[model samples]
Target: MTAMSTVPWLTILGLIPLVGALFVAFVPGSAETAKRMALGFSLVTLVIGIIAATQFDVSSSAQFQLGEQHSWIPQFGVSYALGVDGIALVLILMALVLTPICLLAAWHDVPEEVGPRGGQRAKTYFALLLVLETFMVGVFAATDVFLFYVFFEAMLIPVYFLIGRFGGARRQYAAMKFLLFSLAGGLVMLVAVIALYLQGPGGTDGFLIERLTGLSIDPTTERLLFVGFFLAFAVKAPMVPFHTWLPDAATESTPATATLLVGVLDKVGTFGMIRFCLQLFPEASQWATPVVVVLAVISVIYGALLAIGQTDMMRLISYTSVSHFGFIVLGIFAFTSVGQGGSTLYMVNHGFSTAALFLFAAMLVRRHNSNSKRIGDYGGWQRVTPALAGIFLVAGLSGLALPGLSSFVSEFLVLVGSFSTQPVATVIATSGIILAALYILLMFNRVMTGPKPEELVAEGVTVDEGWRKSSGGTTVRDLTTRDKLVAAPLIAAFVVLGFLPNIALNFINPAVDKTLSYVQQAIPSLNPAGTAAEGSSK
Candidate 1:
């Protein structure tokens, strides 16, 4: 076996942001200085993440690479251990990439040193983003179950403040709801974590996932623990009934915050389903699949339906995420290698697509006369801000899993993977595609391409009279250079991943196979499509 990299690359990747957060918070500087510092740190973190990715050997059978283990609390059997499979690595990299984009996109989100208190708030905002990056990286990288839980719950601190302080009018209400839901979920998972730990072999290495894996957990006990973990993930995934907090949170928070929250943090839910729920309690996972699949299907359809009913663009985008998450969770529990791999890939694709959507939508909203978020507030924007409209359409198309975009391949794999053992549920879930088209196209048509509203348009506007003058007599602007910089990489990712998904899938598929083998989900009756891959164990 190739010895694990000794430099603790994962820890460094996480702590670099931690150091950056502290620096940004304590140092006296203008908001511009803070923003630039934050961007530089996030970019460095991305570079490190990419370096770590290069070290990952795709053909190796190692379950985790670039491992780091250190005993932190010997008496209690808790230690600080970090590692990543292909799945966690991709997620960590995704978060890293999004962090810098969010920073740039939010350059003026908090406004630059406007009031006496503005500079301070701005510094705190960017610092909090850095802090959130640390937690996000840690949450995905931690191999110790206790460490994972710590990072898991710790993420709330930065996110809570980001929403409560920097968000819109109902920021406090949204932040509180989000906290309450996450706390409720975390509390349940804590009990399960404790229970699962106690059930494992007690030693100095006690809380490591390695120790917990394949433990002889009793069937009833296992099911209870699975419920605890799955419930937490479901809430995080914000599936159906528990999803009420998301729209408020998304709508109230800054667009960059919304992008990270929905795009990256929320992914922890589905990520947990794979990393903990299935691997730790295989029998329970199989046992719960039937019902979970039903709930996932409901989330898929219900979320899309709710999105269609939304007039608020941010709220609409938020609902679409709930719907997208449904597809992710559906792919996870579907039990086929392709389904699970697709689910992981979907997480990454969705992050970039949603980031572009939220950021672009925010740009458009900020430019509106009243800065209104209402879909009814604008029309024929394509005739004025064609560049912004163009990227927005790309984002919206990706959301609907349009044929030429990135989401199509992942969504297709999910459906194909689920169809064998879950034909009925898969067919029912497919209806979400039509609903998606309805929401995305309708949203585009209403907000982007149709006849202009009087308030949103200059008095003498016509279709060909593009670049219409606003009420202030200034011609409406398209995308600025900064906007294009943000748009280019995201659009490139979509195009590249769409036609050449193997870029990610090469590693993701092997990880999926390992997970399936470990969970023994390759049993012929349950997942015939993956039976051929049964022997490909980690």
Candidate 2:
């Protein structure tokens, strides 16, 4: 809105990493140089993200801040538009912060391998990571519907290779399944996108979200289009029936890949539900709430239960994400400011918690030389790695939403908001909190506190021979300087957000207010006094 917008903050924030990826790809130096270059670029982007966040005027009446729009394709109504509300801003910031941390976490992930053509494996890995960062930032920032879909589809390319190329043995199968599910959802969305454009004003900037915000359509048509978009998000949110691809993808991908997959990218689903499904089709959103709420509750309970039964640590963490995402979706459809705001905050909180768990778990597995993912393979680690154990415990506690942690606040807000409308479903979803405690503590007890694997095998227990042999004697190394570096920011985030949720909520609540006003859904608890006054007048 101002000449200051000439800076194109969001575009540069996304482009810096994109350009870094290209540079890394062509670097003639060793793998170490590529890694450092990638990390430095990620940090610079983070600095830009923080600057943009500071530039935002929370007091402004505008729904989006730091706006930047330029026409891209005139005839098709597509434009190089970018903007962010409070929700998108926090998500972008989360992605930015996590990128550098993930780089640090993955510093040694790739071993320099020689190819006949002389391509560096590490270069490819780091470049893919930076490319993924660009798409992640753009996906959250795009205000043009067409631009959003472009970033959404483009995201799949780097992720598929990241998993299929550098991940575990079954990586190809997992990658293909993830691609298939995502592509199927994307195709449905493509239909909806085209239908939406056809129904719009059909001009140079017709696909701008602001332009399409309140377009009138017949009930049947609106409902049909809403279904197309919602189906895509549900698969991405990965609510129950469509969520089959996640466990496979998470289990097979490297920790860094899984961190971004569940933490940042998956959020695009719930974000789309808010940005498009509810914003563009308010009536349909209200019409579909009952079913969506039911599906959300199902995701909550089902994911937790599956997590409890998992043997592999990565798969367990993945299922826990499925459960956490359910809570987020539940809050969004609840339609109260408190619920929607909580959902947004939960997205940020869960990203940090899940990333910590996955990265830390991988580090422990690698250090112990167990080369196994079975929870049964790890035992009595409290003595061997006390500092790492303690840090991992904090991450676990955050996952379960223990009181005084950041996640507890968001989870609490979500439940309170949902209870005011869909009390029964909210109550049923509350069981997930109980199940969360079971999985986290039980997993800690089994994987961190019990007898060693060799001792268990000595007592006539069945265990993997490799894990038993690899479980070294007492006094294994603890968290390293780099490990501490990777964790410090995340841990500090938990502490800050735990005690001062308003740091995020202040930015979030204003945008939530605007969204609720735009959607015009009837949420009973949102204004009980006003509703009473209206009834008296009637």
Instruction: Identify the candidate with maximal TM-score.
Output: 1
Clashing pairs in 2: none
lDDT of 2 by residue, 440-464 (tens): 9999898789655343222222332
Model 2 regions more than 4 Å off: 1-4, 114-119, 452-475, 521-538
lDDT of 2 at 431: 98
Worst 10 residues of 1 by lDDT: 457-466
Look at candidate 1 and tell me the lDDT of residue 88.
Answer: 91
Against the true structure, candidate 1 has what lDDT?
0.87
Error of 1 at 53 (Å): 0.8
